[model samples]
Each structure stands twice: as C-alpha cells, then as structure tokens.
Target: MTVKEIREKSNAELLNDIETLKAELFNLRFQQATGQLTNPARMREIKKSIARIKTVMTERELSNQD
Candidate 1:
C-alpha cells in the first residue's frame, strides 16, 4: 500500500492491517519453505507494506507525544 493510503487509516485500522500482513507473511514463508510459492516477490512486498504501516504508526505515536 502507498503511504498516502496508509496515512488515511486510523490507528485501530492500521493495527489491524499490520496483523493481517504479518499473517500473510507467515503463510508466504511457509509456502517458500515447501517450494510452493508461485510469487516469491510477494514476500518482499508484504514486508515493505508492514514496514510502511509501522512507520505510520510510529509517526502518529510521536505526534501524540509532542
């Protein structure tokens, strides 16, 4: 997801999205281990998406603290 889209999500929604992405990442790893992953690039994409969400969350937390 783009940063703009991520920024639009509320904190609760962002947390939920992070959880969902982590689950998907876990499943992707399982598929990779079994050599059944059709789209290996998806793993990287998911990881980046998780990072983006976390970045947004951190930004929000810092803003709140200020």
Candidate 2:
C-alpha cells in the first residue's frame, strides 16, 4: 500500500495490518529456509511496508503528544 493508503487507516487498522504482515513475513522466511520460496523479493516489500506503517504510527503519536 502507498503512504496515502496507509495514512488513511485508523490506528487499530494499522496495528492489525502490521500483525498480518508480520505473520506473512514469518511464513515467507520459513519458505525461504526450505527452498520453497517463489518470490524472495516479497520479503523486501513486506519489510518496507512494515517500516512505512511504523513510521506513520510514530508520526501520529508524536503529533498527538504535541
């Protein structure tokens, strides 16, 4: 998802998305370890998405604290 899309979600939704992504990441790692992964690049995408979500979350938190 793009930053705009990510930013549109509520905090609860963002947290849920993060949990889902983390689960997917774990499964992808397992596939990689067993030589079953078809798309290794997905791992990179997922990591970046997680980072983006966290960045947005932090931004919101800081804004709220002000």
Least well predicted 10-residue stretch by lDDT in candidate 2: 1-10
Tell how far residue 54 is off in model 2, in angstroms: 0.2
In model 1, state the lDDT of residue 26. 96
- What TM-score against the true fold does each predicted structure earn? 0.96, 0.99
Residue 28 CA displacement from its true place in model 2, Å: 0.3
How many clashes would you count in candidate 2? 0
Against the true structure, what is every candidate's RMSD?
A: 0.6, 0.3
List, in order, the clash count of every candidate structure.
0, 0
How would you encode candidate 2's per-residue C-alpha lDDT over 1-66 as one tens digit per residue?
Answer: 899999999999999999999999999999999999999999999999999999999999999999
Q: Which stretches in model 1 have alpha-carbon errors above 4 Å?
A: none
Candidate achieving the largest TM-score: 2
lDDT of 1 by residue, 1-66 (tens): 999999999999999999999999999999999999999999999999999999999998999999
